[model samples]
Target: MTVFSVNHVTTYAYAEPVRLGEHRMMLRPRDSNDQRLLEASLAIDPPPKTLRWIHDVFDNCVAVATFSGETRELRVENRITLEHTPFEGDEFLLDDSARFYPFAYDAEETPDLARSIERHSPDPSGELDRWVRHFLHPGRPTETGELLMTLNYAIKEGFYYERRVEKGTQSALETLARRRGSCRDFATLMMEAARALGFAARFVSGYLYVPDCDGENRHLGGGSTHAWLQIYLPGSGWVEFDPTNGIVGNRDLIRVAVAREARQAIPLYGSYFADNATASTMDVEVRVRQSPSCELPSAPHRNL
Candidate 1:
């Protein structure tokens, strides 16, 4: 088990004071059997009139804040400390029924996993389908785990990692054509491709702990909110795959939220009232590091 500290700060600047609408934030880590939430806090500038926290459909902690006044700049900062138990894929035992390629989920589990198995978009172009089939040769039998691991490494090796400053994610087809994308695009591509091959997968939005392997091997999508995906194997359950870093299982991935699609797992979702011509810009900075070395600031009270 390893402990880590994560700080994420987002600031929005407007030309003039703007009335902030309700802001729903997914910044807290999701505690599970392998994870323990030690302490978490959120601090916002120009305190909102009312603030409440609730769990969303995916059971992620969502902080909803409403402001009664306008401000020129809005800042939302979050600090968390948690212990993440390392997960070794080798330790998981797959049921005999699902040990081979092209395996099927038991009838009892199919109904509940149907939504994840269905692709978010139809692969009319068949571009993604062809890409995924490359792993399984026409006449050769493939190991289920091997096929999935190969697919994970294939994306990391085949595509270029580009930092996109734009809002929203690119389509899987777009990423394939360009052979370049941010972490989210890569995750979406892998997720959709897995679904096309009859695997149940979902989008994951979280933090990545990147320790320097070497200066030349610096990881991408570390100092900001990162995106990845998880595939549910019949016996192993939901296993994480980070094509961005060619990482299998949880390893250095700190999951904050998971959803059926990328859009649903967005870290920050909100709006502000301003003139049609009003121009604004948003800046986000996230830092994740091993614990005890960095000191964290005091967090604001949960109540406004």
Candidate 2:
């Protein structure tokens, strides 16, 4: 049976009350089998100064926001419908014998560690060859899937996902030095390493439900948000990688939207008339719910 209900609310009364907005995403008939019915609505008081387009890496729900004058308020709401499936430890098709998206050994990659990253590293992206290499190295996992798996585990093991106040988000190097970071840092390292290897990769942002076992003290915990990575492959398409839990997707995860980077999937973002890009403050809220009749079969399988 679907358990408790969760509602998230965040308010940022800017120094001065500015115009704002409340955009919404109307859940459509999703193409996934695990999802039954999904619906969501967003409202703004006094309406917004302006409503702009906002998207996330997962491209799940298009968040809406409105601006007033000086104190722009940002409100976000997330509603998800899920059909629980028993934890059966589904089958995993891990491929690693060969490269999916191959490219000629080119100098354009990482002139120093193309091979280190491509073969022994993450994806083909040069952005984090050195950083990712510190975690995943030659022949760690024989399969490409295993390579990613190694990285995921490495991140969870090496970093502490505690909420803190830091200036200028850290880079791959900085993250490696600190051995800690948010989803942004984790995804960046993964993307940079993958791209260095020559495979196309991108950053993704969206919502991920923390396991009940962890309660509210989890990474991307309730009201906090979630982050993961996606690597482009040849025959298999894009694959999701979660370093937080060292696990990929089963039914526990929801695939929302995708984009080149997290900025593209901000849920809601827009430039107004002037250069006042201070972004005084921004807030987001999300909720995932499972219905009563939609019981999670004791046995979780595709039945395929």
Candidate 3:
């Protein structure tokens, strides 16, 4: 088991005071068997007049803040400490019936996984279908797990990683054509490809913890938020795949929120109104560090 302390800070600067709209924040990690949240705290500057917590469609904790006055700057800071038990690989062995390619889910499990199995983007040109077809073999049955691992590694090795400051992700075809994209773009491509192959997949937004192994820094997508995908198998359930790093499990993935699409899992969302010529800028910083033997005073269960 490993413990970590994560700090995330976001600041918005405006040329003049502006009216801030309701802001939604998704900064807390969801509790699961493999991970436990010990303590969490959030501080917002130009404090909102009202703040409330709500669970979204995907059951992610979302903070809704409404402000009555205007401010020249807005800042949001979040801190969390948690314990993560590394899930071993052998623990996810598939059932005998699902060990090979082209397996079916039980008749009872189809409806709930329907939305995730369908592609969210337009594939009118059949580009995505053709891309996934490259992994198929006609006569020989492929090991399902091996095929997925190959596809994951192929993305990391075949494409270039580009850090984008844009607000949204690119389409799957757009990323495939350029062979370069941000973490979210790569994850969307992989998720859509898996869905085209009749697998249920979803987008995951979280933090990547890069440890100092051998006193060298060799990991990507660690200094900020990261994106990946999760595919559901019959016996193994939902398994994480980080195509950006060719990682196949939850070893370094500290999940904060999950959704059927990337936009639904944004860490922060809001709008402000200002004069047509008024300008604004945003800055975000995220840091994740190992807290060897540190512990918090209390375990809080409050939301937002």
TM-scores for every candidate against the unseen true structure = 0.93, 0.65, 0.94
Give the lowest summed-lDDT range of ten residues in model 1: 295-304
The alpha-carbon root-mean-square deviation between model 2 and the true structure, to one decimal in Å, is 7.1
TM-score of 1: 0.93
lDDT of 1: 0.85
* Candidate 3 segments exceeding 4 Å error: 213-215, 293-304
Q: Per-residue error at 297 for model 1, in Å?
A: 29
After TM-score superposition, the amount by which residue 167's alpha carbon in candidate 3 deviates from its true location, in angstroms, is 0.8
lDDT values for all models: 0.85, 0.49, 0.87
Model 3: what TM-score? 0.94
What C-alpha lDDT does candidate 3 achieve relative to the native structure? 0.87
Count of steric clashes across candidates, in order: 0, 42, 0
Instruction: Report clash pairs, candidate 1.
Output: none
Q: Write the per-residue lDDT of candidate 2 for residues 171-192, one digit (tens) a residue.
A: 6656666777877677666666
Task: Write the residue-wise lDDT of candidate 3 on 200-292 in tens digits.
Answer: 999999998876645665567877889999999888889888999888878768999999999999999899987666688988898988777
Choose the strongest candidate by lDDT: 3
Best candidate (score: TM-score): 3
